[model samples]
Target: MSETELPPEPALDAGELDADDRLKPEFVRSVLDAVEEGDTEAAKARVEPLHPADIADLIELTPADLRPALAAALSDRLDGDVLAEMNDWVREELLAALEPHQVADLAAELDTDDAVAIIETLEEEDQRAVLRALDPDDRAAIEEALSYPEESAGRLMQRELIAVPEHWTVGDVIDYLRSDEELSTDFWEIFVVDPAHRPVGTCHLSWLLRTPRVVQVTDVMRREQTLIPVDMDQEEVALRFQKYALISAAVIDAGGRLVGMITVDDVVHIISEEAGEDALLLSGAGDGDINEPVRDSYRSRVRWLVANLFTALVASFIIAQFGAAIEQMVALAVLMPIVASIGGNAGTQTMAIAVRALATNQLTQSNTLRTVRREIVVALLNGATIAVLLGIGAALVFANPQLGVVIAAAMVINVLVAGLAGVLVPVTLERLGQDPAVASSVFVTMVTDSMGFFAFLGLAVASGLVG
Candidate 1:
């Protein structure tokens, strides 16, 4: 059907596309049914009016085994924007089904960063075939982007940005933007560059529109601008964008020449991706995507489970050392888990805050000691509050005030230990050039568990509560 002949999309409610929104089950089922019935035209019509992101979601929501069939049903309706919006694994699966030249065609229609994302997923031989099929300029851009480290600014910034000589007038800039059909259509700002192609300033589109025609671009441009280094990590790039409230920024090479530009749209993706990634890493849940293959998920998770098992053994061994004390006073066994549970919870809380702070560059060498001291104070306050409640309850229930005092003291000790372990584990991992999020929880839990058992049981024995 022709574009004009197609039905208009239904108006969506305000929350229709909220961040947490998912495609309706009915809608997903309807589309899948059409695909299953071999009604390609019906499937295409059902999806045609959806946003690219929603289209991507529909694809993801479909069963993975059925996805290739869905893609085939959609056929020509699947485009680069939808592919770009797709989950990485879903996109990889779809891309694998396409021939190299067909993949090249899709890449040709995307910006350099996205095109690189698609191409880099292909095997080396397939990547070569796709590259050979692309236009020379597109091929060169993708090749250069691929050469950069993954998740770096070079691989994230788009090559198609508006950069003009610093001497151009507002009228000239406007005219050039209007006439350059090949230029990127979605830029918010124009970069002012020197003769040697170094970006010197940036002019927002709004500023250009408000200025007189004859005014020089430099006169209207802001000379001070944040420039991203090509090799900068994508997380750092997101941080810079956030810190400066930047809408767009020029990317520079080793020689400080403008190579490309990164827009806030791209940074939005990076920020979300990084935040989710850190959270997943903290749990040792690799990728944590529901659509991840079972074998892949099991492989990633079992290794961490094994490590946790060993850590649990360390806590078990501590309990063994106090087996005699536990036998004499069964109450010690009953109250032991309460101490460890609270301490473990406290440690997890502190670890989460530390990981988030480290991820956002909030916790640094300069403020590390201050953050640590603050957590220690907070831990003491929490420990005191819980200790009083538990102490009174234990004294009343067990009819032994001395037992209450010993347990209270152990509570304070374990909680303080938990606070220290939480901060120290992540900070130490970071110093060793490892991800602070990945294994910090395991180590912190180990410390809290082992120390909680040791402190509680040792004090019980020392206080003569046990034979």
Candidate 2:
């Protein structure tokens, strides 16, 4: 079947799918029932109508033990597009079961970027085997892409794009597009290149369709275009696409020659992947994909927990310094956690905002001071609001007015400190060339917890409430 046409899908009842059009429990079970029964035709018929993305989702949603059997049952129906859409862990597992030559064939069917994504996931020896199995041209292209830094424009861009010489008239451009069967079937705009193969301008298909046939391509082309550096980071590329509202941008080599093109579709994936990746990193949760292996998940998460354990000790040590005071007044011990909890939560809120701003280029060197000042004001307001509520509650609950004043003062101090740590930790990490998302949370949590305990307990002792 062609890319657009698949075998007709079996008729599904309205209740067979979820509100989001995802395969519902009953539908998935039905497909699994077919596969379990060794009914290949039934399985194919059931999955035929689903989009490639949905098919990928089905593969992931299936039980891991049954995945291989399901894949075997629907082997002929699975394609590169479906593979591209599958979760990396799920796709990797499936690919591991395929022969090198079979893997190469699947990669050949995908766009270069998607193909690279598949190939890059293979073990080194397996990657070599797959590369050897590929055709020479395909091998060369994938090899070049692999050589580039991972997540760079070279790795994300597609080799296939329409680039016409600037000298071509509207008629000539139209004729070439019509006559060239190998040209990419999907594109919004045609790039106009110089004699040196450097991109000079771009002409939208809509513009070409409306313009007079005699008009020169250069005359009709937009000279101002967002040209992406081939070595630019994928996150930065996504930012440029978002900032400029670009549908597609040309990727150029160090010599300023057009190498490939990154469409908004590719940028969309990058944005999503990066966003999820940062979120996972912030929590030290690793990939956080449901399909992630238990072992991998354990390894990614345990180290963070260990670090948090050490940081927790810092707070414990602070509390120990006020041990006498805490023993004298039980209320101090009881109220300390409330202060720490609120402060940690506040810090997390600020850290999330700072990390996102850094990732999206919303917070930069030019605006860093402004952003920091804005966060401080927000933190102060948040601290005061929480302090008043908590202080009143403490006074009423414990019937200790002196304790209320001490706790209130401590709340404001710790919250302000938490806010500073939140913004500063991420910003400093970024400046030092570290990922703000990865280690910022760890440090921020440590700061908030330690300072919250110190501020609260220390204030109670100093105010004679604990003495």
lDDT of 1 by residue, 222-325 (tens): 99999999999999999999999999999999999999999999999999999998899889998898877889999988999999999999999999999988
Whole-model alpha-carbon lDDT for candidate 1: 0.89
Candidate 2 per-residue lDDT over residues 301-389, each given as its tens digit? 99999999999899999998999988888888899899999999999999999999999988899998988888889989999999999
Q: What is the TM-score of candidate 1? A: 0.95
TM-scores for every candidate against the unseen true structure? 0.95, 0.95
> Candidate 2 — worst ten consecutive residues by lDDT sum?
2-11
Candidate 1, which segments miss by more than 4 Å at Cα? Answer: 1-22
lDDT of 2: 0.90
* CA-lDDT, candidates in order: 0.89, 0.90
